[model samples]
Target: MTTYTPPQRTATLADAPAIAALMRASVLELFPRFYDERQTASAAKHIAAIDLLLIEDGTYFVHEADGEIVACGGWSKRNKTHAGDGDAADDDRPLDPATEPARVRAMFVRGDWTRRGLGRAILESCRLAAKAAGFTSLTLTATMPGVPLYRSFGFTEVERVMMTTPDGVDIPGAIMVKDIDRPDSIGP
Candidate 1:
C-alpha cells in the first residue's frame, strides 16, 4: 500500500483560521496525556495562537491534505521564541543570525496525523531555512507532548520550564536547542 504525504507550502495570511483550528484540535486531543484540564485549557487558548508576523515574514508553513491544513510550523528570524506571551516591544526585533539562534516556533500537527513524520519534516524545513538565513543553531520551547519529537530531531533539552498563562495556569515545557551546523545533526 502506498502512503500519501501531504504537500507542504509556505503559509499565507488567508490560512490563519484553518491553522488556528488545527492548533486547537491538536492541543485539545494530545495535551491531556501530559497536562491537567486547567493547564490544557490554558494552553489551548494561549499557546495555539498564530503570530501573523511569521506569515508576513514568509517563514511559516503548512501541510495540506485534502484541501485542509493538517500540520503547521515554522522558523522565525525575529525575537519571539513562542506565541501567547502578549505583546512586547522586542518581540518583532530581528535576531542577528551571525550570533543568535533562529527560533523554531508554533509547531502543531493534527492529532490523527501524529507519528507520521510530519513533525520531522517541518523541523527539517526549519533547520534548512534557518541555516540558509545564516543561523548556526535553532531553538524552540516545546510543550510536553512535543518533547520527544524535538529530541528525535537532534534537539537537546536546555532547561525545563513552567509556562504561566495569563490565566495563571502553569504548563510544563522545555527549552530545546540544536546546533544545525553540526555534522552529526539529522535531517529529513
Candidate 2:
C-alpha cells in the first residue's frame, strides 16, 4: 500500500471542476449528519457559490495529490457592497480580492485526509495568502463541524446566523472572525 503524504500547492482555475466535485462530495457526506433534508441541496449550491466567488475574485486554490484535488480553499480582499451591510459580511455580490480585510471564502478537504491536519493547513494557507495580499482580518460563517477548527485559529463567534437556503429552509451558522495579527500567525 502507498503511504499517504499531504499534497503541497495551490489550485489554479484548472483545478476548479475537480475541487468543486470534491467539495460536493464532502458536503453530501455531511448532509445527513449536519442538516435536515432541506439543507442537503444547499450544500452543493454553496459549493457552486464558492466556485463562482473564487472565479470572480481569481482566488481558487487547492492541494492536489496523485492526480486529485484533496484539499481546497479560497480568499478575497472583502466585499464592497456588504461593507456596511449587516449579516452580509462575506459576500460582496460581485466579489473582490481587494477588500480592506481579507476573508476566507471557502475551504473543503477530502475525507481521506481527515486527522492529517489538511484542514488546518488549508486555513493557514488561505490566511497567509489574504494577509500577504494586505488583509488584516479574516472572517467566515462556519458550519457546526467547523466551529472548533476556526476557534483553534483564534476565531471568535460573532453571532449565530439563522440562514435560509434558497428553498426557504433555515440552517444554523456561526459568524466567526480571526485576527491575523495574533501571535500564532498564519501559513502552511
Cα lDDT, model 1, residue 24: 93
Cα error, residue 145 of model 2, in Å, equals 2.1
lDDT of 1 by residue, 124-177 (tens): 888889999999999999999999899888899999998888888989899999
Candidate 2 per-residue lDDT, tens place, 108-146, comes to 777776556677777777777777776777888777656
Clashes of 2: 3
Model 1 residue 64 lDDT? 96
Q: Residue 88 CA error for candidate 1 (Å)?
A: 2.9
Backbone atom clashes (below 3 Å) for every candidate: 0, 3
Highest lDDT, which number?
A: 1
Clashing residue pairs in candidate 1 are none
